[model samples]
Target: MIEILSPSRVDRARRTGALVGDILQTLRRRTEVGTNLLTLDRWTKELIEEAGATSCYVDYAPSFGRGPFGHHLCTGVNDAVLHGRPRDQVLADGDLLSLDLAVTLDGVAADAAISFVVGEARPAESVALVEVTERALAAGIAAAQPGARTGDISAAIGAVLTGAGYRVNTEFGGHGIGSTMHQDPHVANTGRPGRGYPLRPGLLLALEPWVMADTDQLVTDADGWTLRSATGCRTAHSEHTVAITEDGPEVLTLPRAA
Candidate 1:
């Protein structure tokens, strides 16, 4: 469903967005070599509870994933990209980790994701992959505004990724998000400009741009959730929830200090 949030709800959304961003930022900072994925999940759970927020993932039972994800956050490491279920895995130096999080506070929800390299060693390829996704995410956000079509956001994101010599995947991408986590108006990572649903004020969109190093194909892990690169290539993902307004596009999920 496409939801036009009320101004009061938009205010609540801003709060929810800040909480999500702060938790993700804290998790990113605490993640390092030897850090367990489960630890990150626990941290997320505690923080969300402390803030009186509810997780959008723990009990999430989407058709594409295993019922009741049962995790507070998504932990995608290296080959793992999307829907990465937290497991008993420990981080290794130079490991590329991606964390995706969503939460609802006061009946409003916000979602965001971040990719970063762990430890002191940063591989050039890994760094490049992360940078490209971040840049693509920025482009997507820049294209979000009142009267702008969803394709405009997708096209802007695609231009950046394709220009960086990376393949694009459309199976799973950004979508409308509001009271619930995922909503209508599917936003692909790549598409033609001047197409798809038209944007409007009071609409919230989660613009995510993710890419694999080598191929566009994805293979689901045995866990029935985690999506990995078909070629086992390193991957990166970046996302943020944005609200279209009369003035311009306001990024709700920006880091607290940002």
Candidate 2:
């Protein structure tokens, strides 16, 4: 469903976005070599409960994923990219890590993701992967304005990834998000501009740009949820929930001082 949020709901969305951003930032700060994926999940749950917010993922049951995600956070390590179900894996120095999270507060929801290198070692390839995805996410957000088409956002993101020599995957990308974590108007990572759903004021979209270092193919892990690179190449993902407004696009999921 494509939802144009009410003004009051948009206000609530800001709160929800802030909560999601803050939690991700907090987790990033706490993460280090030896940190377990399951530990991150536990931290997410505690943070969500402390904020009096509900997790958008814990009980999420989507057709593509194993029913009931049963985890509050997605921790993707190295080659693992999307739908990364938290597990017992421990992060190592120089390992690329991606964290995707969503939550609802006051009846509104927000979603966002971030990728970075773990510990003190910053492998050049890992750093580049994270940086490119972040730039793509910024481009996507910049393209999201009132009257702009979703394809414009996709094209903007695609340019960055492709230009950086990374392969984009369209199977799982961004989407309309409001009261729920995922909604209509699927936003692919790459597409021709001037196509797809038209943007308008009050509409919310979660624009994510993700890429694999070598190939566009993906392979699901044995867990039936985590999506990894088919070629075992490192991957990175970046995302944010944006709201269309008269002033252009407002990034609701930007990190703020806590």
Candidate 3:
């Protein structure tokens, strides 16, 4: 469903977006080498409750995933990319980590994701991979203006990834998000501009651009979540929830201090 936000709804959405962004930023700062994936999940739960918000993932059960995600945050390490379900693994130095999160605040929802390297042992490939996705996300957001088509956002995102010598994966990309988590007007990582749903004021979209180091294929882990590169290559993902305004796209998910 394509849920358009009313003025009141958009206000609530901004609140929701702030919460999600704050939580992700907090988690990113807390994550470090030797940190267990479960610890990260626990931290997210605490923050959500402290903010008096609800996790959109706690009871989320989608067809592609094994019923009930059973976690508050998605912790993707190294080759792990989308839908990464936290596990018992401890992050090692230089491990590339991606955290995806969504939450509902005052009945409105927002979603975002971030990828980073764990420690000082920065691997050049990992650094490059993360930068490419971040750039793609920025491009997509720049294209998301009122009256702009979803394809424009997709193409903007696609150019960055492809230009970086990386292949784009469209299986699971960005989507419309509002009262609930995922909504209509699917935003693929790559597409032709001037196509797809037309953007309008009050429209909210979660634009994410993710890429694998080499292949575009993905395989689900046995845990029922944690999409990984088919070729075991490292991956990265970047996302943001934006609101379309008469002027342009507003990134509602920036953290408080930022």
Candidate 4:
């Protein structure tokens, strides 16, 4: 379903966005070599609960994933990219980690994701992958203006990822988000401009740009949730929840300090 949030809801959405951002930032600061994925999940749960918010993923059940995600956060390391279910694994130096989070506060929801390297080592390829996704996310956000079509955003993101020599995957991409986590108006990572859903005030969209180093193909891990690169190449993902307004796009998921 597509939801055009009301003014009050939009205000609430800002709060929800801030909470999500702060939690992710906190987790990033606490992560390091030997950090366990479950530790991150626990930290996320505590933060969410402390804020009096609810997790959009904890009980999430969808056809594509194993029912009841049962985790407060998604931790994607190295080859893992999307729907990365937290497991009994410890991070290693130079490991690329991606954290995706969504939460609801005051009846509104926001979603965001960030990918970064752990410890002191920064592999050139890993750094490049993370940088490209971040750049693509920024390009997508820049294209999110009132009256602009979703395709415009998609094209902008696609240009960055493709230009960086990464393959784009459309099977899973950004989508409308509001009171609930995922909504209508599917936003692919790549598409022709001037097509798809028309943007308007009160519309909220989660724009995510993710890519694999070598191929566009993905393989599901035995856990039935984590999505990894077919070639086992490193991957990266960046995302933000944006609200379209008469003044242009307002990024709600930025850290409080940003």
Candidate 5:
């Protein structure tokens, strides 16, 4: 389903987005070498509950996943990319970590993700991967304007990643998000501009750009949820929920102070 947030609801979406962004930022600050993935999940759950917000993932049962996610945050380590279910693994120095989160507050929902290197050691490759995805995400957001097609956003993201010498995966990308976490008008990471759903004022889209260092194929972990790189290459992902407005595109998921 494609949803467009009403003016009043868009206001609520700002709050929801701020909560999601703040939680992710807080988690990033708290993460360090030796931190367990499970610990991050617990921390996220506590923060979400404290904010009086509901998790969009804990009870999520999508066809691609085994059943209820049963986790508050997705913890992707190194080669792991999407749908990363938090486990007992401890993060090591230089470990590349990705955290994806979504939540609803006051009947509105927002989603976002961030990738970073753990500890003081930052591998050059990991830094490059994270930087490229962040740039790609910015491109995608810059393309999200009223009357612009979804493909424009996809193409903008794709251009940046491909130019950076990374492989883009279309299996899972961005999507329309509003009252729910995932919605229609599937936004692939790479596509031809001037195609797909047309953008309109009030439309909300979660534009994510993710890339694998080597291959485009993905392998699901034994947990039946976490998606990892088929070639065991490090990966990175960046995302944000944006709202189309009469003026242009407004990023709802910026840090509260932003």
Candidate 6:
């Protein structure tokens, strides 16, 4: 269901967005050479509880995933990309880690993700892959506005990724988010301009741009939740929740310092 958040909810959304962003930033900073996936999950759980917020993923049950995700956050490492369920894995130098988080505070929801390399081992290609997705995410956010269509955001993201020589995966992209985690107006990573749902005031969208290093194909891990690259190629993902406003698209998941 698509929800055009009421003004009061929008106010709460800003706070929710900040919370999600802060969580992601915290995870990014704490993730290091010896950090374990389970540790990250525990940290996330504690943070969300401390903030008096709810985790959108902990109990998320959809047809595509195993019921009751039972995790506080998604931790995709190296070749793993989306829906990365936390595991007993520990990080190594140069491991690319992606943290995706969604939370609801005061009945409003916000989602965000960040990709970073661990330790001093920053592979140039890995760095490039992360940069491209982050750039594409920025492009998608720039295209979000009250009269803009989903294609506008999709096209913007595709251009940045394809131009960087990475394959875009549309199987899972962005979507409308509000009081609920996922909603209508599916936003693909790549699409023609001027198509799909029209942006309207009060509409909240989560524009995520993710890419695989080699192929667009994906494979589900043994856990039946984490999405990994078919070729085991390194991957990266970036995302943010935005609110459509008469003034333009107000990024709800921006850092407080921004």
What is the C-alpha lDDT profile of model 3 across 37-129, one tens digit per residue? 999999999999999999999899989999699999998999999999998999999999999999999999999999999978989999999
Error of 5 at 36 (Å): 0.9
* Candidate 6 local lDDT, 1-258, one digit each (tens): 888888888889999999998888777777788999999999999999999999999889999998789999999998999999999999999999989999999998899988889999989878998899989988998899789899999999999999988888788999999988998989999999999999998999998898889999999987889999999999998889999999998888877753
The positional error of residue 36 in candidate 3, measured at the CA in angstroms, is 0.6
Kindly list the per-residue Cα lDDT of model 1 for residues 148-176, writing each as its tens digit. Answer: 89999999999999999999999999999
Highest-scoring model, lDDT: 4
Pick out the ten consecutive residues of candidate 5 with the lowest summed lDDT: 249-258
- Tens digit of per-residue lDDT, candidate 5, span 9-58: 99999999999999999999999988999999999999999999999999
The parts of candidate 2 lying over 4 Å away from their true place are none
lDDT pick, better of 3 and 4: 4
Models, CA RMSD each: 0.7, 0.9, 0.8, 0.7, 0.9, 1.0
Point out where model 4 deviates above 4 Å. Answer: none
Taking the tens digit of each residue's C-alpha lDDT, what string does model 4 give over 1-258?
Answer: 999988888999999999988998999999989999999999999999999999999999999998789999999999999999999999999999999999999889999999999999989999999999999999999999999999999999999999988889999999999989999999999999999999999999999999999999999998889999999999999999999999999999998953
Query: How many residue pairs collide in each prediction?
Result: 0, 0, 0, 0, 0, 0
TM-score of each candidate structure, all chains considered together? 0.99, 0.98, 0.99, 0.99, 0.98, 0.98
lDDT of each: 0.95, 0.93, 0.93, 0.95, 0.94, 0.91
| Candidate 1 vs 3: which has more lDDT | 1
Span of ten consecutive residues with least summed lDDT in model 6:
249-258
Residue 251 CA error for candidate 6 (Å)?
1.2
Runs of candidate 6 exceeding 4 Å displacement: none
lDDT of 3 at 186: 99
Spell out the clash pairs found in candidate 5.
Answer: none
- Best-to-worst order by lDDT is 4, 1, 5, 2, 3, 6
For model 3, what is the error of residue 132's alpha carbon versus the real structure, in angstroms, after optimal superposition? 0.8
